[model samples]
Target: MNDNNARRVVSVIVVNEASVLSRITDLFSGRGYNITSLTVAPIPESKYSRLTIVTSGSVRVIEQITKQLHKLIPVLRVYEHEDMVEKEMALIKFPISENLSDINTICEAYNGKIVNVGENVVIAMVSDEPKRIDNFLCAVKRYNPKEIVRSGAVALER
Candidate 1:
């Protein structure tokens, strides 16, 4: 990707109602934009929901998105992450027969720890920077992770 076309995280607050998500997604698809990661959740006890979208585009394209999003009736606010605190969560399940001590040690190093241990599997939960989670996943291959899932980035301006 071009240096000028760096990835960006945008937080959009919109009315929690039908067709809002589809309309936002349509706007991106219609413009040939790509969303790398998208997460939507209701703002607790509120009439709005928050959407965190990760995408890459030129400065002009991003500006266009901001302007267009503002025109949407349901959209309340849009924020571009600039000097923001971002976090992502990941869960990995490892074979129970694997070395539990080693997995626990690795998890501890990354601000993670055992969340549950079933008869045949161990589940670990970790929350950290995106890169740290990626590194943890790489280190976890030795333990034979049966499955892994990662949440999309959720950021707040610090």
Candidate 2:
């Protein structure tokens, strides 16, 4: 990353169609732009889907990408988010023998909790700001996590 490179969150609203996602992703890949995180979800009671994309680029690079996104046929709107509420979720599995109380406390601090307990594993889910989630992942390393699954970033302009 360069000094000019900064993380950006872009939200694209598009008509729901089978090929829309493929085309959008193709646009990024074809242009050599990297998408660090992408979250797509259908808008409730609407014929559209919202795609939240997280990427790092210089200001001019992000502007170029946004301009190209608007040219796609199915795209309804595209904008870079500012003053947004963004979040990410992570699920970490630890051995059953790990300290459940400690894990639960950590999860609670991150707006999550142990959601599942199996005979041999315990799954803790934490949803929080992306940076905080990164911190949580680091904080839990001492417990010897068996597996970890993290979701892409999602955001909404506040």
On lDDT, the leading prediction is 2
Tens digits of per-residue lDDT for model 1, 2-114? 46679888999999999999999999999898898898999999999999998888888888898898889999999977788888889999999999988998999888998
Clashes of each: 0, 0
For every model shown, what is its TM-score relative to the native structure?
Answer: 0.94, 0.97
Instruction: Give the range of the ten consecutive residues with the poorest summed lDDT in model 1.
Output: 1-10
- Cα error of candidate 2 at position 37, Å: 0.8
Query: Which candidate has the top score in TM-score?
Result: 2
Candidate RMSDs in Å, in order, are 1.6, 1.5
CA error at residue 44 for candidate 1, angstroms: 1.6
Worst 10 residues of 2 by lDDT: 1-10
